[model samples]
Each structure stands twice: as C-alpha cells, then as structure tokens.
Target: MKIVELKNISKRFGTILANDDITLSIEQNKIHCIIGENGAGKSTLMKILFGIYKQDQGEIYIRGERVNFRNSHDAINLKIGMLHQHFMLIEDFTILENVILGAELSKGYKLDFEKSRVTITELIRKYDLDLNPDELVYKLSISEKQKVELLKLLYRNSEILILDEPTAVLTPIELKGFFKILNNFKAEGKTIILITHKLNEVKEISDKVSVLRKGKLVYETDKEKIDISELSRLIIGDIEDIPVRNKIDNGQALFKDYITVKNLSLIENGIIKLNNLNFALKKHSVFGICGVEGNGQNELIEVLIGLNKKFKGEIYPEKLVPAIVPDDRTKKGMIGEMSISENYFLREKNLRFAFKNILKNIELKFIKRFDISVPYSGCKVKYLSGGNQQKAIVAREIMLNHNILIFSHPTRGVDLRARDIIHNEIISERNKGKAIILISSDLDELLSLSDELAIIYKGTFLKVFLFSELKEKLESDRTSLLENIGELMMGVVK
Candidate 1:
C-alpha cells in the first residue's frame, strides 16, 4: 500500500527554491531511503510532511486521502513519527518518563506512572529493546539514547517511522544490531523512512532509494539497481577519486612533540569515561581516531582541549595554543548569538588589538581564505547556514596559526560542495606541518584522511590500523578492515 504520497511539492525560502515541484511515493512496510547532499531539501520536504513547514504548493496524501497537517500532533495522530538527527530527550528525565512524555496515561486527575511502566516494559520486551526504565537519560550512551528514541515511536504506536541519520553516531557493531532491529520492524509490517548520507548503509538496509538534488526527486530505484559509487555520483554529480597527497619531504621538524596525553582517565557520573589513555601527536601528519560516538571520543577531545579537567591524566603542551572543532558544533563548537567576527576573535586571541578593538580587515581576510559565505564579518553566527558556520570556524581556527588542530566531524551537517572545501582546508593544514587529531564516525573519511587509524571503544584504544596495510588485510583475511574497526568500536571482539 502506498502510505504517503507527495505531488508537485514546492517550497521557496527567499530567492532560494528549496523544493521544486518534487513528487514521491512511500510504500507500506518498506525501508525507504532519501539520499542527498546537505541543503538539498531533504529536511525541508520531511518538515512539510511533519507540519513543521508549510508548503507553498503541493498536495500530501496519506492512505489515498488528501490531508493537511497543521502541526506535528496531527501527523502523530495519523501514526507518523520522526526522529531527528539531534536527540530531543530531556536529560533529567528517566527512560520511562522520556518515552511516555506528552502521551502520558492519566487516571481521573493524576498521571498513572505504574500503568505506563507496565505497558512500556511489555513494548520493550516485544521489540527486543534493552533499556532500564528507571535509568536517567543523562546516564545513557549515544546508542542507548538512540534506542530510546526508537522505543518512543513504538510506544506511540507509530506505524510509519522517519529516522534522520539514525546511524551517524553508531559504531559498526551497534549498527549491525540496529539493522537487526530494523529487520524486526520490517517483519512486523512497520514502514520506515531513512534519511542519511552514508551510501553503504542505504545499500545494506533500504529496499528502495530516492535521490534528491537541489530539492527535486532526480532518481528513484530499487537497491538491486544501485551501488555506492552510482549513488554518490547522482547526489554530487561526477567526481574523481580523492587522491592521497604524497608524504611531505620536509626533514625540518616544526615541533618534536606537538602534544601528548598520559594516563588519562575520566570518570563521569560513576562511569569510566576514558581509561589509561596515552598518545603522542607529531606535526605534519593527521592522527585519526576512528570510533563510534560516545566511546570516549568526546572525553578524549575534552581532556585534550582543557574543557574537562576531571580526569586522571597528564596533559603535556597544556598551555599550547590549539583550535578545536567539536563534534556537536551547535553545542560545543560555535556560539550562536555571537557574530562570525567574534567567533574569529575567540579562536585567535590576538585578532583584537591591544586596545580591545576588533580588527575588521584581518577578520575579512580569514573569512575569504576559508570561503565563508557571510554578508559581513559582523553577521551573527546563528544567521549563517550550518555549512557557512562550519566554514567560519575552520577559517578562524586555521588562521590563528595554532600549532595543533583538533577537528571532530569537520564536514558534519555540511553540503557536498562545502564538504569538499573543508576537506581541502584540512589538506592545506597538513601541508603546513600542523599536527592534527581528526576524530570522526565517518569510516570513509577516516580511511581517506588518516595515515594511521585507531578505534576507541569503551574508554580504550582497542585496535590501530595503518592505512597502507589495510589492502593486504582485506585481500588475505577476506573481511573488511572497516567492518572489523566498526566491531571494535562497538566493543565486539572478533
């Protein structure tokens, strides 16, 4: 059955036509994927369906009946639920409380917690979801929180579930588990709509795929007809292979030991965040930490940047000037209310003159170099798009002449064009002999950028793989190094 259908949907934001007469149909009980570059209107179209945005022109049909959703509640009542990329759970709430929120069970005048707990337990068992009802949201890991979100939809009796980048934070082993859960959903005749940029995942889980480019549905095909390369080409047009730069021949060492961490162990909320971690960074090379999010990646970055001092670690180069781009940029990387120039100044302490005056000329030069699309240096960071905000951060961080750069998910939430620009910028920094620690969940990125990749799992570096040895292992072992790395990331021993 065709559960949802959109006909000639068009939406415009000022001069930008976000969606241009796009048409799509989603079937019942199938994993339908929507793939696109960032800002390609995937989010906009989903928003229109969820009643977050009003379409200028188009008709949406649910179950062959034309309907207009005024708000998310209407869509929810129609058995539709959406899981955004960013979690929407209250940190203070318990797992059961977060799941049953807004749709609480009430008896006469009071809320019925007992009844809800019993019902939630039954649902969790039925879905094979493992979660402690009394556990606080703040205590759960990223993957656990994601499972909670899934349970939220199931609790609502949502027949059609829309997940945006569901596996972006998951490790390889966790992803396998996730796929198993998805298969269970499919078996139970539940419809799923997945929006993601990971091409291999689309191939693994989706039955049908749709490609959106510049807000239009440009390609639709079955999984059997599509491959990763083809999908990549469709989304970003033709692109050449990413060439690995030759090792620089500069014998002059900018710094013998750029950064070092010893015996670093962070204990947060009674959890061993990172355990006895030790690493040394050298200039002119990128040290890539390949792991699933929540596997001490955040803690490692925090300890290095002097943000979280609640750790048993000796951090050398403690006072060395460093620029860091956090994984969750909206939360830790950039200040929304501040202007781009202010962010620039924050990154480079000397951007302001001794008189405490902003140097407009110097800021503009950095912005242009980083290709930040801002109307003016004084424009508020929040006003810029996600890609532009990232660009601004990169611009500021690189221009500061910081000896070490810590980039977490550098190209996250960025469009293809902007992602390319960011990649080039990372390359430029490497060429300049700046020591970098690149932490990312994107496997392809890790393979492409890192000379050495280490998988961090449950507060420890489980395994390290040299990129040069990956091909030989793949040929001899008859298994994927990436998959093995993913398994290690999820604490699965192979």
Candidate 2:
C-alpha cells in the first residue's frame, strides 16, 4: 500500500519556482531514495511532507487519508519524523535525557526514568545502534550521535522516517554499519525516505528511486530498473568531462616546498588536540589529508593560518598567508547577507585600490569562467544554491592569485556537476605551480586527487601513502586498498 502520496505539489520562493507541480508517491516499508542536484527541490518536497513548508498547490494523503499540516508538530503527531543533516541534540545532556526531553513519560507527575531507560536500551540493541543511554552527548563520536538521533525517532514510534544527507560524515566502516541498521529498520516494517545525491548509496540501499531536476520530477524506478549511469545523466544533464589529475613522478623532488611543519603539537584543556606532526606543502602538487572529524584537522588548519599561536611547532615560513575555502561555507567562508562581490574582496588590505568596480569586474570574470549560476549581479550569496555558493567561494579564492591554497571539504554538500568543476579547478591550479592543501573525509576524493595522502588519527599522522604506490595497489586489488585505508583511519592498524 502507498503510505504517502503528494499530488501536484508546487512551491515558489520569489521569482524562483522551487517545486513545479511535483507528484510523488512513497510506498510503505521500503527505502525510497530521492536523487537530485543541489537546489533541485528534493529537500523542498520532503519538507512539505514533514510540515516544515506549506505547498502552494498540492494535496497530501497519508495512509489514504487526506491531511493538512500547519507545522512540524502536526507531522510528529502523525508519527512522522525528520532527521536533518545537522543533528539537533543537547550537548550537555545524556543520551536518554536528550531522547525523552519533550516526550517524557509521567507516573503521578514524576518523570518515569526507569521505564524510558528499559525501552531505549532495547531499541538500541534491537537495531544494533550500539549507543549507551547514559553517555553524555558531547562525549560521543559523529556516528554515535547519529545513532542517538535515530533512537529519538524510534522512541516516538515513528513509522515513516525521513533522513537528509545522513551519511555525509560517516567513514567507510561506519557507513557499512549504518546501512545494516537501515536494513534492520526495513525488516521491522518501517518506511524510510532518504534524500541524497550519492548515486552509489542510492544503488546500494534504495528499493525505489526518484530523480528530480530543475524542480521537476524527471524519473522514477524500482530496484530492478535502477541504472547509475542513467541516474547521473538525469541529475546534471551532460556536463563536460571532469579533468583528470596527471600522475606526478617524484613530486617531492621536482617541486619547490612552499611550507613545512616540524614538531607541531596543540594542547587544549589538558587534552592533546594535535600530536607531533611533520609535513611539507610543495608547489604543483596536492597534499590530501583524510580522517574522521575532530581528529585534529581543524587544529591543523588553524595553526597553519596563524589563528592559533599556542601550538608548539616551528613553521618554515615566518609569515605564511594562504587563501582558504573553509569547510562550513555558511559560517567560516562567507557572510550570507553580503553581496557576492563584497564577499569576494573581503580580504583585500588596500581599501583604496580595491574599488567597487574593480571587485565587481573580478567577480564577473570568475563567475563566467567557472560557470556559476546567479540570478543577477550584486545578489546576496545566500540566495544561491549550495553548489553555486561553493563555486563562488572557490572562484574568489583562486582569483586572489596566491601561491598556496587550502581547501577544506570543498565539495561537501555540492552536486556531482559542481564537484567535477571544483576538482578540475584544483587540478588546473596544481598544473600552474600553485601548492594545494586538500582536506576531506571522502576517501574516493583523496585517492583521486592527492599526490601524497596522509591518515590522521587522534591528532597524529598514522601513515602517508604516495600516489604511485596507491594507484598500483588500487589497480591490483581495490577492495584490499580501501580496507587498509579504513583500518588506518579508525586507528585499528597502527
């Protein structure tokens, strides 16, 4: 039976029509994966179903009964729950406390802790979430925190669960475990609605797949008919081929070193955030760093940029300045309310020389060259989609003409088209003799781009792999190569 049905749903934000008469049906007890590029209206459609947005023209039927939701509370009352990309958990509270915050059971006006504990513990074990109910939220890893979020929905008896980009932060090993948990949910007869752009994931776990493009439903298929190449073609519509990274033979000897670190360490609140690490950045090469988050990547970036001078280390360059594209583009990279041109020239030292016209000209140049989609000139960066917003930041930094560049998760939330564009640009810059520092949680990205790849665990580098060596091994046995890398990231293989 169809558990949810949306008919002729349409949503508009000013001149932009976010959803154009989108009609979709989600069956019961199946994983329905919605695949689309950034700003393709996948999230919008789900939000409408979750009561976070009101569709301008649509009729929603839940379990064959037409219903109207004014807010998220209404959806929750109907046993529907949404898990956003950014988790909503109280850091100071324990897992059990966070789960039962709003919906606490009562026994004669007293909160029933023992009853809730028993139920939560059983749920964790049944689903294999492996989360401790008594553990503090701040003490949990990203994967564990996600389990807590799942526990919240299951505790509410949610039959229909909607997850948005849930696997973006998971490591390879953690991702396998997460997929297994999803299968368990399916076996328990619960429906799952997953919104993501990862084609491989859609192929792996989805029973039904839907494609949206330019705010319209383009294709729908069952598992028997799913095709990854066709899905990619539908999402981005014939973009140019992605630029390839040429093999670098003896890169360390051929290129000049731009920056070097020796005995780098950082201690915060009596806990070591960065261990003794030594590395060098060379022109015409990309040094890729991969690790689970909170494993000293942020600390390393801060120290390299002179943000934290408390670290015990010796940087070769006395005054090193590099253009950086931060991981969290909304917070660290750009101001939302500011115009694109204004954010582009934010770091300029000479106000007199950085005229408005000159800045606008540079912005226009890169926008055209990079194929950034903008509605109009002088538009605020916030109005652009995630992919366009990322392209803007990347173009701005590259236009600065710096010898060294630092990119932190440059393609974190972008579409395949934008990811390809950014990868090409990075390769183009390396070919121009510019040193690049690439930090990403994605193993495929690191393997494809890095001249020298390092795995950091607990604030220290476990091992560094050369491009030629990894390429040869990957060509021989792909599975073994990934297994070795996954073990290194988790510190399982010392």
Candidate 3:
C-alpha cells in the first residue's frame, strides 16, 4: 500500500517553475531513493511534501486521507521527518537533551528525565547507534551528530524518514557503517526516502529509485532493473565521460615551481598540526591532498593561503595571489546577504565609480558560462540551491584569473553534472599553466585529477604516489591500490 501520495503537484518561485505538475508515491516499508541534478526540483517537491512549501496546485493524501500542511509541524504530526545536508543540533546541550528537547516526557507537571533516558537508551541499543546519551553534542564527530539527528526522529516516532545527502560528510570507512544503520531502519519496517547524488549508493541500498529532471518526474525503476548509466543520462539528459587528467610532456620538466614550501610546521595549543611538510607546487600541475578531514588539511591550507602566519615554514615568492574556493561556501566562500554581483567582485581592490555595471556584466557572463540558475544577477546567493551557490563561488574565483588556484571540496554537495563541469574547469586551468592545489575527501576526485597524490595522516604525509605509478597499479591491481589508499587514509599503514 502507498504510505503517502502526491498527485498533480506544481510549484513556482517567481519566474522559475520549480516543480511542474509532478506526481510521486511512497510505498510502505521500502527504501525509496530520489535522484536529480542541482535545482532539478527534487528538493522542492520534497519540501512541498514535508510542509515547508505548499504546492501552487496539487493534492496530497496520507493513507487514503486527504491532507493539507501549513507548516513543518503539520508534517511532524503526521510522523514525517527530514534531515537536511546541514545538521541541526544545539552544541551546548547533551545528546539526550537535544534529542528530547521539543517533545519531552512529562509527569505531574514536571519533566521526566529518567523515563526519557530509559527510552532513549533503549532506542540506541536497538539501533546499535553506540552513542552515549549524556555526552555533550559539541564534542561529537560528524557521523555522531548525524546519528543524533536520526535519534531525534526516532524519539518522535517518525515512520517516514527523509534524508538529504546524509552520507556526504562520511568517510569511505564510515559510509559502510552508516549504510548498515539505514539497513537496520529498513529491517525494522520503516519507510526511508533518500535524496542523494551518488549512484553507487542508490544501487547499493535502494529497493526502488526515482529520477527528477528539470522539475519533472522523468523515470522510475526497481533495484533489479536499475542501470547507473541510464540513470545518469536521465538526470542530465546527456551522457558524459568521467574527467581524465590531461597529460603533460616531460612531466615536471615542462613546468616551473610557482610556490615551494620547505620544513613547514605548525604548533597550536601544544599540539602539532603540521609536521615538516615539503612540497613544490608547479605550474600546469595539480597536487592532490587526500585524508580523513580534520587531519591537517585546514592547517595546511591556512598556512599556504597566508591565513596563519604563526607557522614555521619557508615559502618562496613571499607574495602570491591565490584564488581559493573554500569547502564551506556559506562561512568562507561568499556572503549570504549580498547579491551575486556584489559577491562576484568581492575581492576587487578598486570599485569606486561605474563599478556596478562592471560587476553586473561580470555576473551575467559567468551566469551564462557556468549555467548558474539564479532568478537574476542581483539575487541573494543564499537563495540559490546548494549546487548553484557552489557554481557562483567557483565562477567568481575563476574569473579572478590567478595563476594559483585552491579548490577544497569544490563538488561536495553538487550533482554529477555539476561535478563534471567543475572537474573539467579544473583541468582546463591546469592546462593553462596555472598551478592548482586540490584538497578533497573524495578519493575518486583525487585519483582522476591529481598529477601527484599525497596521503596525509596525523599531521604528516604518510606517502605520495606519482600519477604514473598509481596508473600502473590501477591498471594491474585496482583492488590493491584502493585498499592501500584506504589503509593510508586511516593511518593503518606507515
């Protein structure tokens, strides 16, 4: 039986038709996966279902009964829960307190802490979450915080769980465990709605799959009939090959070192954040750095970008212009309140007179070139979807036209099509004799683009693999190569 149904749904945002007469259904006790490109209206349709947005035209039914939702509370009352890409939790509160915050157990006009703790502890044990309820939320890891979000929904007796890119923050090692947790939910007869960009994950966990493209439901299939290539084609309406790193003649001989660091080290609060790092970034090359996040990636980027000058290092050419696309777009890359045109020329040294027109023209050019879907050049960037926001930041940074480009997790929350576009642009820049630093948690991205790959762990480079060497190993022993990289990332190998 269908647990929830949406029929003839349509939504619009000003001039953009976010959802165009779409209809979809969710069956009971099955893991349903939704796939789509950025701004393809997948989120919009889901938001309408979750009561965050009311459709301009449509009818919703839950278990054969018609319903109208005025806000998220209405959806919650119907036992529906959504986990967004960014986590929602109060850092200062304990896990138990955060979980039972809005819906606390009451006894005789007083909160019943003991009863809530017992119930929460039982839930944790049943789900194998392995989280201590009394632990403070501020000290939790990324995965732990996500588990807390899940606990919140479970505590409220949510039967239909909607997760948006929940696995994006997890490492390859953590992903397997997280998927197992999802399987646990499914085994317990819960209906799960997963919105993700990774096709491999969809193939692995979904019982049924649906595709949305340009605000329309274009395709649907069962797990037994799913084809990844066909799904990709449907999402983007065209098939494109994975990006291949361009080959340079005579390797490092044809390129000059744009920046070199020797004996680079950083110590903070008596903890060594970076240790004796020595590397030279050469023009026309991509030096890839891959590690489990929080293991010196931030420290290394900070030192290189001159954000932290307290580090011990020898940097050549003391003055350098570096174009950086930071991992956190909201916090570091762009101002949420500013218009696209304003953020585009945010770093300009001179915008005294007639600069508005110049900025507007620049924004228009990039909007056309990058295919950014914004209502207008003056739209606040925060209003754009995650992928479009990323595109805007990338466009602005690339238009800076600097010789040194630093892209940190550039394609974190974007779709496959956007990923391809960004990857191609990175390669194009490298071919133009621009030195690039590619820092990412995605091993596939690193392997696809890097001329040389470094595995950093515990504030040190455990190993650096040359492209030629990795390619030979990949051609001969692909499994062993991945195993080696995985072990290196976890600090299991010296």
Candidate 4:
C-alpha cells in the first residue's frame, strides 16, 4: 500500500523554486532512498513532508486520506517523525527526558515518571539501541545521539520515519550495524524514507531509489531496476567524467622533511585522546588517516594546528603554519555572512591589499579554475550552494600555496562534480611536491589518494601500510583486503 504520497508538491524560497511540481510515492515497509546532489531540493521536499515547510501547491495523502499539516506538531500527532542532519536535543537533559520532553504522560495532572521510565527501558531493550536512558545528552557520542533520535521515533510509535544524512557520521563497522537495525525496523512493518548522498549505501540498503535533479523527480527505480552508475550520472548531469585518483606512483620525486610529530599525547578530561601518536610527513607524500568518528581525529587536527597547546610531543617545525581545511566547513572553515571573496581574503593574508575590492585578485583566479557557481563573488557565502562554498574554501586554501597542507573530509557533502574537482586539485598539489595530511572516513577515497594508509582504532594506529604494498595486496585480492580492513576497524583483527 502507498503509506505516503505527494501530488504535484511545489515550494519556492524567494526567487529559488526549490521543488517544482514534485510528485512522489513512498510505499509501506520499504527503504525508499531519495538521492540528489547538494541543493538539488532533497532537503526541501523532506522538510515539506515533515511539516517544517508548507507547500505552495499540491496535496499530501496518507493511506488514501488527504491531509495538511500546519506545523511539525501536527505531523508528530499523526505518527510521523523526522531525524535531522544535526540532532535536536537539550544537552542538559538526560536521554529519557529528551525523548519524553514534549510527549509526556500524565495521570490526574501529575507526570507519570515511573511508567515512562519503565516504557523507555523496555523500548531500548526491544530495539537493541543499547542506550542508557539516564545518561546525559551532552555525554553521549554521535552514534549514541543517533540512537536516541531513533528511540524518539519509536517512542512516538511513528510508522513512517524520515532520516536525513543518517549514515554520514557512522564508521564502516557501525554503518553495517546501523543497516542491520534499519532492516529490523522494516521487518516490523515500519517505512523508512532516507535522504542521502552516498551512492554505495543507496545500492546496498535501498529497496527503491528516486533521483531528484534541479528540484524535479527525474527517475525512480525499484530494487530490480536500480543501478549505481546510472544513478551517479543522474546526480551529476552534463558533468565531465570523474576519474578516481588511484595513481599512487608519480615517479621518483625528491622529498624534504616537512612536519613530524613524535610521542604526541593529549590528555583531555583525564582521557587520553592521542596515545603516543607518531608520524612524519615528507614533500609530495600524502598521509591518509582512516578511523571512526570521535576516535581523536579532531583532537589530532587541533594539536597540529596549535589550537591545543599542551601536549606531550615534539613537533618538528614547531612554529609550522600550514594550509588547513577543517572537517566542519560551517563551524571552522567559513563565516556564513561573509561574501565568497571576503572569505578568501580571510585565509590569504596577502590578499588584504585591496580594501575596496570585493574579491581578492588571487581569489578570482582560483574561483574560475575551481568552477564555483555563484551569481557574483560578492554574494554571501551562505547564499551559495554547499558545493560552491566548498569550492570557495578549496580555491582559497590552494591560492595560499603552503608547502604543508591538512585536509579533513575535503569532499564531504559536495556533489560528485565538486568532489571530482577537489580530488584533481589535491592530486595536482601532491604532484607539485606539497605534503598533505588527509583525514577522511571514506575508505575508497583513502585507498585512491593515500601514499601511506593508516588505520586508527581507539586513538591508536593499528597498522600503517605503504601505498605499494597495499596496492599490490588490493589488486591481488580486493575482497579479502576490504574485509581485512573492516575487521581491523571493528577490532576483530587486533
């Protein structure tokens, strides 16, 4: 049965027509994935369904009944729930309190605390969420927070669930476990609507897939009809071929010692974040680190950038200033209010020569080279699409021309076209004898770009493999190597 249906739904944000007559149907008890590039109207449509936005045209139907929701409360009352990209919870509250905040049960005007607690505990056990309801929200990790959100949906008895970027924070091992839980949800007759960018995940878990381009439904494919390569083409319309940068051998290149960290140890809140970490970078070499989120990647970056001053370590080039692009683009990379050109100027100190110029002389050059699509460089960075914001950052960082560079999740959340451009630029920089430290959760990207691959588990480097050895083993038996990596990540091979 069609559990949910949208007929000619349209939404406009000022001059931008976010959703133009989008018609879609989501069946019951199936994983329906909606795939699109950044700013391709995926979020807008989902927002409309979740009652966060009112459509200008068309109607929503649930089980053949036409309905209109004035706000998220109305949708929630109707047993529909949405898990946002960033979690919505009060840090001061416990998990149980956060889940039952708005949806509280009362007996004769008094809150039924014991009943709710017992129910929450039962639900946690039933769903296998492994969450302690008494735990403070602030103390939980990303994956734990995700489970709390899921628990909220289950507590509400929401039959239809909408998850936005659900797997973005998951490790490879955790991702498999997440999917297993989702599959269990399906077995229990709940419908799932996932909004995501990862094509490999779409192919792996989705029972049906829909492609949205320029705010219109371009294609819909069932499990039997789905094809990842064809879906990739749909996402990146009219784009040139995206070559996977797997060429590790760029001929014998002269190397110079740039940055080295010896016995790096950071103690935070009495927890050892980095356990005697040691690494060295040489010119033209790309050192890629792969690990689960919250396993000290952010701390390591901060230590290297001198944000965390107190650490037991010896850093060669102690006063090193390298080109650094942080993982969280909005939080650490750019200010939303600033124009694209102005952001560039903030990074490139040498571009501050022009106070009257909206764009730096060097910023304009790389903007065109990186293919940042915006009406003007003077436009606010926030107004530009996610891909363009990323492009702007990449262009600015590259223009700085620092010998040592650090990139964390450089291609994350960008479209395939932007991803291809960023990869090419990184390779070009490496070819020019620049040392790069790449930290990413993407295994394919790490394998493709890394001169040396390191697998980090629990704040310790489990194993480091040279590019040649890895490449040979990978080429000889790709499946075995991938399985080996997965085991290593989960501590199964430790």
**TM-score of each candidate structure, all chains considered together:** 0.86, 0.91, 0.92, 0.90
Candidate 3: 10-residue stretch with minimal lDDT: 103-112
* Shift in Å, residue 242, candidate 4: 3.5
Per-residue CA lDDT of model 2 for 140-183, tens digit only, reads 88789999999999998899999987887687778899999999
Tell me which residue pairs clash in candidate 4: none
- Residue-level lDDT of model 4, residues 221-244, one tens digit each, is 998877888999998887778665
- The C-alpha RMSD in Å for every predicted model, in order, reads 4.0, 3.0, 2.7, 3.0
Q: Candidate 2: worst 10 consecutive residues by lDDT?
A: 102-111
**Which number leads on TM-score?**
3
How many Å off is the CA of 479 in candidate 3? Answer: 2.9
Candidates' lDDT values, in order?
Answer: 0.79, 0.85, 0.86, 0.82
Q: Count the backbone clashes (under 3 Å) in each candidate.
A: 0, 0, 0, 0
Over 1-494, each residue of candidate 3 has an lDDT whose tens digit, in order, gives 89989999999988888899888899999999999988888778888888999999999998778999999888988999988767789999999999988766431335678998999999999999999999999767778999999999999888899998888777788788889999999899889999888999999999999998888999999999989988988888865556655555436666678899899999998989899998889888889998887788888888888888999979997777799999778778899998777886667655555377786887788887677888656788887887889888888888788899999888887888778778888988888888999988888888878888889997899898876786678679878888899999999884
On TM-score, the stronger of 2 and 3 is 3
Give the distance in Å from residue 480's predicted Cα in candidate 2 to where it truly belongs: 3.4
lDDT-sorted candidate list, best first: 3, 2, 4, 1
